[model samples]
Structures are given as structure tokens and as C-alpha cells.
Target: MTSAQPSGEIFELQADPEVVDKAALEGQLPGSPLSMHRVAKGHFRVVVSGLRTDAMLRYRFRVHRKDLGRWIQVSDPFAWQLDASRQRWSTRAIGLEDATRKKARPLPRRPTFDQLVIYELCPREVVPKATRYADLVTAPTGAQPRFGSIFRAITRRIRSGYYDQLGVTALELMPILAQGWRRATPQGVGRPFESPTERPPWGYQAMSWYAVNGDYGTAAELVELIDAAHARGLAVLADVSLEHGYGGKENGLVTDLWPRWRVPRPKNRWGLLELDLAAPGAFPFVVGGLRRLLVDLGFDGLRLDWTEKVPPKTWKRVVAEVRRFAPEAILISENPTLPLITEAGFDGTWDFFFHWEAPLLLRRVYRNWDGLAKRLVSTQRKLVENLEGRAYPPHGAKRVAGIDPAKGPPVVRYLESHDLPRVARRRVRWQHGGGHLMDVDGDGKTPDWLNHGSQATSRLGATLLATLPGAILLFQGQEHGADDELIWAHDPLESRRDAKTFGHYQRLLKLRARLPVLRQNDLRVLLSDDKRHVLAYSRGEDPARGDDDRIVVVLNFAPQAVRRLRIPMPSPGRWRDLLGGKTYPCGKELTLHLPLAGSLLLQKLGKRQTLGKRQTLGKRQTLGKRQTRAKTKDCEPARYARHASKPVSTSR
Candidate 1:
């Protein structure tokens, strides 16, 4: 193997650890190692002939830098294994037979971009003791304990109809590559289940691009997990940090291989050395590492973290390389600048602008219905335009090709994520006027519904998040109404899961799955009234489904119940509230009663039925033995009777 180290004055391969240790005991220069000859100005190479192909080899480079007097220990820049457990700058070589023994299953069929409902989670958090890949997927035995494996637990849950109930088709995991930090105890070796202050947080700071984090299990274990997920018809996406490498004096390729381009950028907030992708050897190395993850590791897709910093040319090349190897793999970007990033071969980008704006609308922070309505309509229009291949003028990039607006919005929509405070936690704080809302009562338990009303508030947000026009993403614990913020290094208590919150999320997801029209990009703001604290919108096209397969959503963001509110009808017919199974006959408009912090999802059933006045119908008619009523009041238009039943008023 050959490598170019610009500062290299002398370089030797220390293949045998015992030989190197024996030289150290002699207190003399380690001589007669596998000598590397200078092949080029800065390139060095060595060929170790007649080595056993199946042997596990440990090697490092003893480089005598021209600038630095002392020899610096460096690992191979292209090493497939950098075992941090054996200490930093360590490399391990395994036999091809061992590495290829467990063949990764073929890529499974995945949902289309428009049909994705993603669930994001941290492996460590999902299964507290999941330090191995098998730990995540291993099923528990009666002889073993609970939470044995995430994969096994999930499989059981799925078979038992737990995960399928949530209606998410894909799973996105946080970075699982070799991370820089490990749990170092006084006894010596570090553990993964240490306290947050004790161990490094999330695996954001990667030490090796090609190696998996051993703490989270082995390469084979990960393959097993992926295989299980694929078998269960779930697409798995990995969150990858390609913008930079380990920072702050970490002795790895990021710091050792490319000194000139490894300089830290002032704009890098993560205190990491930013890779100059344009630099020689950088692009190939990065792209090769990504390929290994997709082609070898068997990931269904990649969520490129913080891709905004990467140059466009570099992105194009990286994406081209990725697609060449894995054309069906989904590529999503965490870049805030969309359309521009989407043009660079990404299937979608995180909708941060939409995420930020959504909370304001939910909280009624602007406090004006007219303004809110206009903003909602305008934002939807802009999103539609962008999805239709219209580039933002400021980006100066051409419209994205192959974008079909009718397919749906090409973005990942979420109310909560790893970067943001959990929606439930934020709701609790907001309700308590920014104070601590996790206070427990006399029973040593926090009431699910506090005086601040976070449960209802969170449910309202969930409805919007699931029903809005875009691919949906749910952070871990968000489904169960976890009020505590996710602390990466610590394990979440079992007590945090709320059945009510879980039920609410399940229903919303089920509703989303039931209504195909909800997945379409067609969104229209039918009504927005600040004074009444009501916002009404419709999704889906009437042309596609002549009957009202279209869904109309009505949201009440007020503290008081709204009575006799008139909502415009798309077409005079029987509007059925899917949640309550109640129907209302309408001419041009329908009067509704929405309670505080409520929502109504109405689907047009069919054309209205007209009855002669002489043949008076009963006050209440039974549909499927369920009572449906028509109540009218004086001063209201004498038209078809609107059911007085407020379906959206049911308690969450």
C-alpha cells in the first residue's frame, strides 16, 4: 500500500506490535521494520510478501516528520478498521473470509419518496444496553432479561401489531460510525452506558469513516439488524457526517493525512476539522467511505448531516459516486437551503423553515387569523413552486429536474428532532410560562395533563405534523409524548412513555395511512380567522376522486370553545367527521362547534340527499345504529340541517 504524507521525512510500517515493543525495551531506534521506499516526492510504499491471508494484523506508521523532531504514530488513511478500544491511531486487519462470512442481504424494496413516514431514533436511547448490533435485534428468551435486543423487541412489537400501528414506513438512525469519545473509567476501559458527564455525547464526532462504533456492536451485528429491518419491510437510513471529521487534536487521518486542508474553519461550530473536498485524495476517500456504508453495510439511504458547508462540485461528485453504486438508495440532506441542495442529487432536504414557522402558527404567537391565513397560503404556494422545479432566485441555481409537483412535496416535515427541544417538553414549558413543568405531585408522579395543558397542545401539533403535505418524521419518544428532553449519553426511563400520547400518535398515523389524499401535495387554505382562532385547509383534488376523498382539516387554537362557526364548504354534500363518524348536510357552508385546542378532519362523503318538507324526517336518523342528528337555530339560513354534534370536541 502507498500513501502521500507531505511532511513525511521517514516512514516505516510497524506491522508486528511485539517487534515494536521489543525495540522500545532496547531504548534504541526501532530498526529493520517493514521499510517503506519513497515512491514519489511525498508518496511512500511497502509490500509485505508471503503474509497469511487469514491472519488478523495490527499495524501503524512510525512517521518521522521533517517539521517535528519526534516520530508521530499514524494509522493507515484507508484502513477499514480503526479500533479505538485498543487506543487511538490503532488499525486492525481481518481476513477476507471473516469479513465476508455474513453476507448482507440484498437491498429491500423501499417506499417511494412521496410515501415515506420516517421515524428517527438513537440506537443507544431505543435500547439502553444496545452496545452491539445484535443487542438491537436480538429477541429476548425466557432465560434472558427484557430489553435484550432492539431488533428482537421491534420484531415482536411489529408481529404483535405495535410498530405497524404507528404507520411509519422508514427508520432514520443517528450517526453510528466510529465516534471519537468512549467511556473511560478509573478501572481503565470505557463503557457506553456511563453518565452523560462521564462519556462523550452522541457519535457526531467521527473517528473513522469506514469503521462502525464497536460500542454499538460489530459490523456483522449491524448487518443483521439491517436484514431484520428489511425483512420486516422497513427502510433504514443512516445519518452520516461528511462535512468534517474528528476535531481537537484527534490523531486520525483527518488530522494526520492531509495537514494543509485539515485546518479548522472558523465557521465550523462543531469544533471539527473541515475536510477540503476539493483537495486531492479527499473526495475519493469521502466518496469511497460513503460507498462502503451503502454497498457493504447495506443501509437503505443516508441522511447527510450539515451538507450546506460542502461545496456544490464536491456534492455533485459524491452523489454521483453514491448513485453509481446504489442508485435506489435515498439521499436526504440536512441543509436548510433547499431546491439548491435538491438540485445537487438529494431526494429531499429538512424543512427547518417550515418547522420553525409551524410552532408559531400553533401557539398563535402572531395573534392574527388573517395574517396567519395569508402566511399559511403563501408558504404552501412557495413550497408547491419549489417542488415543481422552481429555484429560488437568490440561489442562482437552475430548477431541479425530474421534479413532478403532482407527486407531492419533496421535504421531510417534523415538529421535533434531535436538534430541537422535544415537542412535549416545549409544550410543557410554554404552558407553564417557561417554567419547569415536570414537577411531580404528592403521589411522586407528574400528572399527564398538567394545568398548563401540554397534552392537548402537543396533540394539536401532532395532527398538523402528520396531516401536512410532506414526508413525515417523528423523533424518538415524540410518539409516546415523552416530556423529557433527549439527553444523548443517558438512558431514558421507562416511565417516560405515556399510553395516551402513544394512542394519540397511533390514531394520527392510522388516519394518515387511511387517507391517501393526505399524502398529496394539493393544499389549499379554505379559512383562517384570528378572532375565532380557527384555521381550515383542504388536501387532495376533487378531480381525482369525484366524491369527497379530499380531506378538510379545521383547527381551533383558542382557549375557549367556538360556537356556531361557519366554515365554507367545497361542495354542498354530506361532510363526515372521520374521527366521530358524524355527518352534516351543507349547502354553501356548514356551522361547526370546536372546543379549545381542537381539530376536525372532515371528508366529503357524497352528494347531499334532499327530502320533501311534507314528508318530515325523524329528528334523529340512525346510520349503522349510531345516532346522527340535524339541529337548526333561528337566524341561521333555512337550508340542509348541519349536525350539531361536534366531532372534534372529543377529549384526546
Candidate 2:
């Protein structure tokens, strides 16, 4: 162990008395323990070979302070595991050999970067209250304790086809590592942690990097969850906080190992200590933890939390080490620092700007279509620039990509996330506050569309989200349009689910899965009109291919239907509405009537694939003139010939 201190001090390794006796009884070690030798000033080393790997062993260091009065006992900062049965931390062996020797499970086949539909859920919140780890209460007999396990709950959901029905390709779990707050029973659930006076239900304040949070489950149970998710064809991405370590009384590594390198002033509410990335031994320690999470735990990927606070070089190194250990594992950042972080092998980052801008534009809260169009164009341009390796400016720059179509969208799009206010809450507020209630008939009464738990609003937003070119992220309960604001302490188990909203999200997700163009990056804005509050876009291969599979999306932000709106067509003869199954014929332009807060997905139809009357017209045209004349002369007029001669109606 290396430590920085003043000169002339002795360091000693102290194995637990019981562990030494157990090792002796098992004939795994010699009776005498090794003495520490000073390798450098304030740095010491002890070569203890032939230690038992099969048993749990505890150890600490006896080192003299700079004052050199009394030797202090401290746990190893780099200990792979910590014994949490006691009040104070003690180093534990954790059967490293067995853990490493267990047959490594192969990761499940992951979705392509563009095809990912991420469902971010806190495992602790999804299960019933009585089953949650933090909500476990003593039995009526007061002898036994019962609680919920994330493993079992997630396994149940997977078996129930909840995620499958939602078309979720990936599951992004909140942190499951050892966190700061203690697990409280149902009787003590409302009680707060002493230092913070409030516990964050989301496990962001990591106390131990190596140990799995016992409250969540054992390490083996966590592996079970990963394996089950994989079996269900879902990639699991863990949220890890590498930016800082927990502080206050829960400061585990910062207080024990790298006290000198801890930066003052908490970076967030958890009272976390920022680590100095440049400091000696810091990078390796962080990388070691990452290896433990990825290599040891078998996760498919990691979502690095609050990456902006970390030095770019440090992050690059961490990502490199992660890739080295698990080459196929995906690396994503919560913040969109693309090209910057992407250069370090990051697949994508969260599109916070899209999360913000989409709501404003779609809600008609900000009705400047020109400004919205400019922003969209600018964002798309920068995303392309980033994908092509062009340099851009620093933090909060406009050059960052939002939701756009590309081979791999640099940013992941979401209407709601843990970091943002719930979309349902916003919808509820807008509906109650007289924000153009989308009453199509203008009856001056609250419409059914407004009463179905914001189903219509959610459908509109979800349509925009699913159709956009990017990896999509859905927050927990977002599928059901959950209205509860996700505060740090709020329990997810209590959140209400709306069946109508859930069905809408499921349909949108299934649509996204079925449509290949929605996953591609090729996009062209066909029209964006401010006065009409309408935006139209097309996604497909290069416009040069007339027969390439193309989907035209029209979104109406206004509260009234826009009739006979002429939208430019890409050589459209017949177009089928993929969602509504209605077909419309077009020449150079197509006249459309879009309902308020409604969206239309139109796919160009091939001549041979035209349906209903359009197919009859095609057949009549293909017939020879002799056959047509023979039939027409006998019958006066052919039914298909008359149908072909009439102009195709544009009514929906």
C-alpha cells in the first residue's frame, strides 16, 4: 500500500485474529504474518504469499500518524470487498478465486446502436412496497424479516413479457452498487439518514465500489438478473457514478484510501468528494472498480453518470480500460459530450436538448416554428459534424446533437428521464391550465381525448419520439404515462399506471420496431410552417432511389385540424398510412388533413403494391389496347377504365 505522510513512521499489516486462526487451522498460511517494508518515503509494501482464497478473511493496516504518537487501524482502501455486517468497515476476502473461476456467462446478443429502445427503471421502485429491500418489515412474530429482491421482481416482469410487450431492447438499471443509506424496514422507512437527513431512493451515492448493495441482493442475485434480462433479449446497462465518491459519514474510499486527493466542496446533494484524476493510484483504482462491474459482473454496458465533472483524459482512460476488459460492452455518458467523449469510444450520450426542446415545440409552449426549425437544422448539422469527426466548442454548445436521423445518432433521445420532470406531470399541468385542450369539434366542453389520463398527449409525444432517428430512452412508468414527479425520495411502487397510456406507448414502440427507416439517420424536413404549427419530415435512403422504402411523418402541434395542407411529395403515386392503413394518391404534392396533436406516418407504395381502387387502376393501365377496346366495345365502358380516368380523392 502506498500512502503520503511525513518521514520516520512504521506501517504494519494486521490480519483479523479469527481469520489468522482459521487460516492456521486450515493449513493455508504460516502462523507469523509478514511485516511491512518501506518501499519509498511514506510508502510501504508487504509480500504475503500463499494466502487462502477460498475463505473470507479480514485485515487492516496499523500505521503511525505524522505526529507519531499512537498507531491507527485503518481498512485497506483497495480492498476488493468490505464486510458490512458490522458498524465499521472491515476488509473481507469474498472468495476471489471462486468468483473468477465460475463459468463466465456469455452476454446476450445486443441490439444494434440505432435499434436500441432503452427502458430506464430503478429496480427498487418497480416492485411491491412490502417486497422492496428498503421496505422490508419485521414479521408479526417479530423474529424474522421479509423483503423484496430486485432479482426476483425483474425476473417476474421478464417472465410476464412486460418489457417484451413494450418492445424494450435494453434495460438501463439505476445503481446497484453499495450505496450510502442504510436499508430501513417498513416501520423505519420514513426515518432519514443522520448526516443527510434524507435518503435518495436512487442509489447514486455509492459508498463501496467493489461490494454489491446488500439491500439490492447478493452479487450472485445481481448476476441472475443480468442473465435473465439477457435471456429475454434485453441488454442491461448499469448506471455508474465515477465522477465522485460518497462523503459525510458514508465516505468509504475517500476517507480511507485517498483522503489527501479528495476535493473540497460537494459536487452534488449526496455530499460526494470529487477525486483527483491526476493523483497517483486514482486512475487504476477507478479502472479496477469498472473492471469489477463489467468483467466480474457481466453487464452489457455502463452509463457513466455526471461525466462532465470528470477530466476528459481520465474519462478516456477509464473508457479505454473498460473496453480492454470487455470489448463488446457499450459505453454511454449521461451528458452529450459527443465527438469529445465519442472520440474515447463512447457510442452515444443522452440528448437532453431534445428532451427539453421537443416538449416546448410539441406542446406549443414555444410556437416560433422558424426558431424551432433553425434549431432542428443546426442540431442535425452538428450531429453529422460530430459523427464525421469535426471539432466543436465546449459545454452547453449548440453544436451538440439532439434527435436526428444518422447511421448512429450521436445522442439518445427521450421525452422524459430521471433527471427531468415527468412528462405526465407536464401534460397534466398543461391540460388543467388552459393550454389548448385539443377539442377537435370545438364543443367548448372537456373532450374525451383530455380525460383518458393524458393518453392523447402521450401518444403525440411518443409518436414524435419513436419516429425520430436515435436510440430512444423511456423512464420508469413512462410507458403508462405516470404523473408522479420522480423526486429523489419518491417510491416508484406507488406510481399509478394508466392502461390507455400504456397501450399507446406499446403501439408506438412496436411501430418503431417494425419500421427500419425510423432507426436510420437519413432525414429531410419536407415542411415546417409556423402559422399552421405543422412540421413534416421524411426518413429513408438517399432521395435518388425512387423505390427505396421511405416514410413521411407529419406532426400537427396546433389544437385544430389543418385541412387541405399541401405537403411536397417525393415522387408519390400512392402512399399508405402505416398507422391508420388509409392510402392516398399524389402527384407532386399531397393534400392532407391532420387532426390536432395528431401524427401521420406515410409510406410510399410501389405501383404493384397499391391497394383497393389504386390496384384496379394499375391493372387497367397494364392491359393492351386491343383487349381494352374489345372489352370496352362490348361493355360500353370498363369499370377499371372509368376508375382510372377519375381524379383520386384526397379525403381521409
Candidate 3:
């Protein structure tokens, strides 16, 4: 094969000569067939004139397999758009002129990294079933259930202020890129089913990095959805799986042609074919795909999936190149106990520690409540320290060349995610023993204790999550008490108890936005009571300064109400409960009555006012009847005995 600069439209295909004997470009140019010459070993190229650079170009490539001995049509590995029905490729090869004509727009205005509240949703799942099948009979084969209308529906809702009301600043879209549809056996071999089955709801099994999922929607529709979100002041983040690709029958680009791109032994836990980043041209291929998603299409950021599988050196290079061009783009990692935060220069990573350990504390399963309290306080301090770059440099602090002192890291905090079970559906297995406590009930089994007060427990978790420092995430339907598990075949947007749970989240988010101290990095543990199952923390720029901006959050995790609970305050002032709209005067210590599974958001009052008669705070709404009695025998002082010599507050 030889190389040359062509004057007109050029098409190229890189393949193994042993696999492909011949190739041709089948386009609309009215030619019988445009034969492609072998420009290099295992490489073919064709150039044609009379093609309009401004118009959308549609074409397909046909290759004659050496084994099959007949020409067959296959998709281009680098196609921007694929006509799933015809199995064709589309592009406008205007070259440099195209870039000049369509200048990339600046990213939409978004809140600071610390203030981000991300709402994750799958595009196909958000739309109703009836809507997806409306045009099924009239549409061509494999073209029914088009998601373009769903994109428009979401865009309409965004324009209608739905997201603003929900108080989320960003939308994290699940994978929409072309994905593998082939089923895999228990032995991890991709196979074709004799009969068709419903496609998976999630898009984790990626087929083409560049092509938009035709089943999901057209590229134009996706662009419109993102643009509309931006207009509504909502940043859009794309979740990309760079660790592995679909190794099914559909991935002919790698299987039949570029087999060298696949690793000798797949390393991904998902049993998919992992990409060999060390191979020739692999780095540029991945980088080009990233540029397409972030530069050509305007995505505010990316939530990289399975970041642990990728090498830190490769991630560092990828992140450096992306940051060089898109400086404001936020890159998040998805490794549980991520060790690459600073090395890869990601803005944030999933807080798996919170996801795994928070339930243990909430369930009160520990024998020593003091140990649990200490663990909770220390975990929170570690998170804060990581974000502030005190213990480790923040995500973006380490670039390709050296440390970048200007960039600070954010944290990704959530109770429910795509990987986690919903709070209502979660069954607490022995976090230590790995055995869930189950009870038989009329031929059906249910988890004991966890079923009781799930709603209240959910609210408690949300309260603690929202007040902590991080980019908080609320999975789809999680804010509205959707108890069903994530079904790959079917996902409904609405739930039975939407009003109550939705209202709680709406109010909680609005309160977080209204309070400036909640968005800051400073945190101090004010109370961690073991006996009463109560905890309190203060958030502010400086709680020791005793300013009016200081905010204290008190939580009661007990199954029953606790009376005369006292928590020390930073200063002598009148504090108001923002959630319940109650006020109390405090000198150094504040005493209060809290309901079962209750929480309080207290903000210091600048001036003194007459306090109303003390009333018991409202009890949080619960779901089940099962309750666990707390052990109140072991009594402790207001502060930990180990910290008796220190001040009342523990600021890390």
C-alpha cells in the first residue's frame, strides 16, 4: 500500500491483509464502484472528486473477506454517525473549513465544583413504554422505539424548569454510544441468540466509541438535548466506558480486522474485550474518540467508567491532553477506593467508602458505639482532607509536566447509583458476615429491621449526604422513593410515592442552595452520641470565628424519640431550624428534643428575638413496622473520654 494527499473526498480503511482480500467505497457518486488501492500493508485508501463539503455525506464500505470469499458490508471504525437500518456511515469532510464554519461553543455557566448536584438518568429509561412503541408497526426493521422524541421530551421538561425545581445543576447521562447487543454465555464467549430479545436499558457494552447509539437517538437529537440543557443552566456530563468494548459478533472492526487491538487475556471484570492501549495507534484512537465527545460535541464533562482497569500512565496522558484543550471540563473517575485521583488528574472520584460504611453506622450494628462514632468522624475528615489537598494533592494538581496549584478537587457523594441498590430495596446483609437477615412472610422473603423506617432512614441519609462537602448525586427515581430494582429491560420514571419523597428532596436541595456555609469545605464534629444514636456537625468558613454564618446539623438515628439531648454550640447566639422553622437560644451548650429518625439544620441568628414555646420536632415518615431497640445501658459524657483534654469541637 502507498500514501498520497488527495484533492477530493478521501476514504481509508485499516485492516489485516490476510483477513481482507479486496475493498471498495459504495457512495452516492453514481459510479459503479470506487476501487480502493492498498496504500500500505493492510491499509486501503480511495479519493473521489465532485463531493460537496457543506452537505452531509453518506456512504458505506464493502470488503471481500479472504475466508468468506464474498464481499460484505461493515461499519467504519471511526464513523461519527451510523445508519443502523442500512448499516452505512455519514460525515461532512469539510476539513479545516468545517472547523472555521462551526466554531465550538463555550461550555454553559455552571456552579463551582463544590456546589454541583448531579442527577443521573438513562435516556431510554426516562421515556414511557407506550411512547417507545408508538411507531413500532410503521417503522423499518430495527428502527422502532426511536429515542429522538424522548430527547425532545426531556429538553421540553428542562425548558419548563423541571431540573431547576429539582435543584440539580448537572445531568449525568448514561452511555448513549453504540453498544454491543450480543449475549454472552457463562464462559464469557459472545454469541448470537437464535431469537431476538429486548435490548439492555443501560449502555455499558460499548460497540463504537464514536457512533451515537442508533437505538437511543440520532446525533442531531442528542446535540439538541445537550444544548437545551445548557440553555437551562444545566451542565451535561457523558458517562464513557474506556476500559473495554463489546467483544460480541457486532464488533467486526476489531475481531475480523484489527485483532491486535485486543489484549491477549481480557483483564476487565465484566468479561468484555479490553483494549490494548499499548498497541500501535491505540493511544491516538482513544484520544480521538474523546475529542469527538468533548470537543466536536459539547459535553461539559465525562464520568469515566471502570477507571481502575486503565493504566495510570495512559490516564495521565489522556487527561493532560483533554485538559490542555478543554480546561474547564470536569473529569471524574469511577474506581472503588480509587488510587488514581491525583495521578490521573481527575476532578473527583466515586466515594465508595461512604456507600459501603454509611449503612453500618445507620443500622447501629457496631458493638462499640464510640468506635463507630470515631470511624464516622475520621472518614469525613479524610474526605475533607483529600479534597483540600492537605493530605494528597487534589485531582488536577498533578498535570503532565508538574503540579498545578490552581486546580482544586471535588468529591462525588451518593447513597444510590446505577451500581447500588435503591435505599428502599436494600437489604442489610451482615456487612461483616456477608449474610443478609431475611424473614419468611407468606411465601415471600423480606429483610428484617431494614424494612422498618426505610423512608425515614433514606431521609436521614440524604440529610447527611447533602450537608457534607462534595458533588452530590441522586440516581433516577431515588429522590421520589422508587423501590424497584434497576431493570435492564424496563425502567419507569415515575413512582408510587412521588409526592412525599420528592418534596423532601426538593426542600433539602433548596435549603442547601440557600445556605452558603453548606457549600464550603470547613467541617467540625459537634456531637457524636453513642447512647442516643445522635450526631451533630457544623459547616462554615470558620466555626471557631463564631460568625453568624455558621450552620449546625443535628441527627437522631434512634428508632424512638430522644429527650433533653444536649449538643455544644460554637458561640452564644440564637439559632434557627431552617427545615422546621423553630428557634432556640444557646450560650455554649444547646439542649433539644428530637423525634425518631429526625434531623435539624440550624443556622445562627445575627440578632436576638423572642423564642416561641418549645415544641417537639416532627417525626420523619417511615415505611415498615419492624424496629430495632437501641442499647442505652452504656452511658458516656458529652464528649469522648479520649478527647476529654481537647476542646468540645473536633475540627479536622
Candidate 4:
């Protein structure tokens, strides 16, 4: 079978002879109906005598079904464009490259996965309610008002230079595939009902893999937005769903065209039909669509949704094929528990370890602070060990054979995502609720719940995220401490912007991008003060190189200030506080006052100053005298504890 060229008159599609008996193509113009001849078991082709290459040619395929004893109309599964209202295939038939290749300008340099600080946003939430157009007056009365599309809003953001200013290297957009044409209900038993609207169900219930969501914009508009991003030196990643499609057993594709293409949904969850990867001609179809997205649509990477639900072998095969075509593409899985991402040939996986445990640390749930710190360290170590194919004793899992560890950590640490409730609510119901909301103070009723303490905890979380050894992701509005509960098809933080919180994240992210030590995968615990609720650690690369590039992070988890707290110094000399822009002298330790949930990020200064013998002696005497007095003030009772004892050191 011959396929259409960049400007050809012939069109081709793939179908199994075992599934389809005969096929015909239909177009909108005169002399519409065209016959398709089967040249091979899985190849079907048709020729148009005088077809235009510039204008969109709306068309569909009519297939003869043996089981139903009737003909059925189906859209081309490989169509680059879709007529949303009609649910038909619409394309210029000018080859997929004409969409993005001519429009997307060259980027200065594409960032690697390790260098990427990803920002994930849902397209649905980005569309503005109403935008005023200067020239065209669409509304009858007042100023010209037009409802903006998702792509337009995002293009405006890119032109405004928000992402560049925010220091994010890549934009990870949520699924943009055709969705929201129908709803899945228990009564319908996987039957689809018409429910088209501006806002869809987060684009997870995808209708077509090859078509752009109509609500967002046309395929051309989407390409322009991506080109705008590339012009600004930013990479774009597409979040895709491969586990299942939107419709069920009653769907036309499942019942008529390709019955063997689907498998039973596991436990009938979500009433969605799963794709049978083992089916004949399935891999080529899936891989072709993915290639179109990456190569033709100009996407730099993919974030596969719900990857753990996909069979391990199927996932491996998909990764291998995608790598064969797009070797530099970044592939990250949504599976957080598994550390063998490199074994499956994935760049990274979601860091559920940090997502699950970091909040507990912020809440100060564990009384034994040192023990909790050790557990956190141990958990991170186990992740490394598992990636290196070492035996894990806690889970009784042996060494995974034939796995090679990558140079960088295979995790993407994030504090908030679309899957979980906001951080404020999570902290309020700190005890139980399975990361969901309960009847609590943080349920939007208590404004005080989002006060000073909450912001401090968020800043603390951001500090840990920046200093951690992996790629990082910040969900929409997360950089500014958005605390609204994640409701389906709703985004509360879209209209809210806190300059202070935004500035905080901007400073940290920019620092992380510039500092070599922050990007490296080396950490050493320097101090853990259980009584004062403080933890200090040093992060750097190559210890033998000394303290030039070493960074020290000291965190105070207490709700109240800790006065005259002395933290041990890794090296004795002068040190500079990168965050506060202050310099201090150190012998064996340094003393400072820490605010509520405050942190100090310090780096050793190369220039050292020596003090005279008498001056050093006098300083030591004064510090010793003040240490006794400071102890009484620091020995306050723990707020969350009853009958607390005097503060004491329990560092390891």
C-alpha cells in the first residue's frame, strides 16, 4: 500500500483483514465516495484524482462489519486533525510535519532531564473567562469581549516571559487529546452521553489520541503556542494516557472495528476499556501516534499517566520503541514506588517518597526528631540502593538482576500535583484521611489556617525540594502557596497570585539552577537537634575538593523562634548566608536566632580573617557566658507534647 506524501493525492490507513471485510472513504466535496482496495492483510489505500493540498479535507471511512451485517462510519485513527462537533476526520492531508516544522523556531539549547525544573499546568484551567479584544467587537453591547482559548492564554504567558522569569526550564502540559464528549456513569454501563462543555474532566478521559482537544484550540493554534515557547527557550512536555480510552464495551471501535484490540478493565475500575498491547498491529498504531506527538507536534518529552497500571513488559516495549525514534526524548512515569526506572529505560519516576513523608516532617508528627531525620535519610538511601540493583531488606525484595544505575537520581520530587488535595488541607487533617479532606479547620472556613505558619511550612518544603537530588516539578500555583482543595474540573488558584510566595520560589529555583552543588547527588547529615526541632545537612560534590562549592542547609521546624541556637560548622572559617546575604565568623560552631519554620542556606567563604590571641580568648569567654543564659530561654516546653522535659542535644 502507498501512503500520501507531503503533497500527494493518495491516502492510506491500516486495518486487519481479519477484522474488516471491505472499506470505502467519504469526503465532503462532489464525487465524494471513494473505494479503498486491500493490498495486504493490514494495509488499505485510496487515491483522489484531483485533491487540494492546502484546504482541510473533511472525511471518514465506511467499513463493512460482518458481525452486525451492516456498514459503520469510523474516523481515521491516524488523522492529524478532527472535526469536534461532527466527530469526523478533518485534515489538509499535507503531511504532519507541515503543522509544526515550518512554525517552531530553533531553540538555543534543549535542556536535559537533570537540568529541567518542570512546571505542570492544566490547559482547561488556563483559559480566561472573558478577554477584551481591541479591534473586533463580538459582544453586541459593551467593550469587545471574546472568550479566550487555552492556547491563546498560554501564548500570552510565554510572551509575557513569566516562565523565563520563574526559572522553569520546561512546561509540562496536562493531556490535550480530545475529551469531554461524554460521561461515564454506572447506569449507562460504559455508555457515552453527550456532555460537551468548556471545562472537561481534566483531559484524562481522552477521546482521541491524535486530535487536539477542541475546547483548547485548533491544531494550528496549538502548534503556534509551542513555537512561541520554543522561541523563548523552553521545552514542552505532553502528558499522555496510554492505559485506557474514554468509552467502554458499547463503543463502536470495541464492538465493530477492532474487538480484539481491547482487554477487560482490571476490576472494572472507572468503567474504561483498556488497550490490548498484545493484539496484532497494536504496537505500530500506538507508536505511530506517539511519534506524531513528539516529532510532528514538536514536544520534547512525555509524562505517561498511571504507568503502574500498565503491564511491565508492555511499558518496557513502548519505552524501547519510543527511544528508537526519539533518542533524546525524556520519558517519566507516574509510578513512584518503583526505583528501577532506569531498568525500564525511563529517565525518571514521580518521587512519592518525598510527597508522602515531607508533610509529616513539616507537621512535626514524630517526637523523636533525630529518628525521623534518620528515617528520611534511610528512605532516600534505599531509593539509591534499589536503583543500583541492591537487595532491599525492609520489603524483603532481593537484588534486581541486569539493572544499571544512571548517573543522576531517577526521581521527580514534587510537593503538589493534580492527583492530591492541597497542602493546607493535608496538614490540617494530619492524622488520618488518606491524603483526602475531612471536617477540619483547613476546609476553607478558617482563614487563619492559611496564615503565617502555613506559609513558613511551604517555604520549608520548597527548600527541601530545591536541595534534593533529582529533577523537580511545581504544580500550577504551587510556587505561590495555593491551598485550595483539588476539586474536579475546578481550579481556585487560577485568579490568585501572591507576590511574596512567588518571589520566594523564584529565588530558590534560580539558585538551584545556578549552583552546581544543588544539582549534584551528594548529601551528608551535619546536625540534627531533636530538642530544638532543627535539622542541618551539607550538600556538595566530591568531598576531596573541599568546601568551595559546599552548601549547608539548616532548618527550624518549631512554630516559635529559637534564640541563640548554636549549629556546628562543617569547617572553621568565614561563611556566607546565600539567602540572607550575611557573613559570620566560626570557630567550631556558629550561633544565631532562627524564626518560626525558618532556614539558613550557607556556603563557606574562601577569604579567612584571623583574630589576635586576646581577642579570640575574650570572644570565647563571652560566648561561653551567653551559652548558659541562652539555655534557659531555649528550654521551652514542646507545644505538641505534654509534661515536656528540659531541652537537650541528641545529634548523631
Per lDDT, the best of the predicted structures is: 3
TM-score of each: 0.74, 0.72, 0.77, 0.79
Please, what are the lDDT tens digits per residue for candidate 4 over residues 15-44?
666768888877653476778888776567
Better of 1 and 2 by TM-score: 1
Q: By TM-score, rank the candidates, best first.
A: 4, 3, 1, 2
Runs in model 2 lying further than 4 Å from the true structure: 1-104, 134-148, 182-201, 266-270, 367-409, 426-453, 488-494, 610-652
Point out where model 3 deviates above 4 Å.
Answer: 1-10, 16-21, 26-34, 47-59, 64-73, 83-105, 133-148, 189-201, 336-338, 360-409, 426-450, 488-491, 608-652
**lDDT for every model?**
0.58, 0.59, 0.63, 0.62
Model 3 lDDT, full chain set:
0.63
Give one digit per residue, the lDDT tens place, for model 3 in 89-185.
4333344233213433454676777778999988777665543421212233222223235566667767888787889889999997876556543
Q: How close is candidate 3 to the true structure, as a TM-score?
A: 0.77
lDDT of 2 by residue, 329-425 (tens): 8888877655444455677887655654565555454321222233223323232233322322322334445323233346688877766555656
How are the candidates ranked when ordered by lDDT, highest leading?
3, 4, 2, 1
* Location of the lowest summed lDDT over 10 successive residues in candidate 1: 20-29
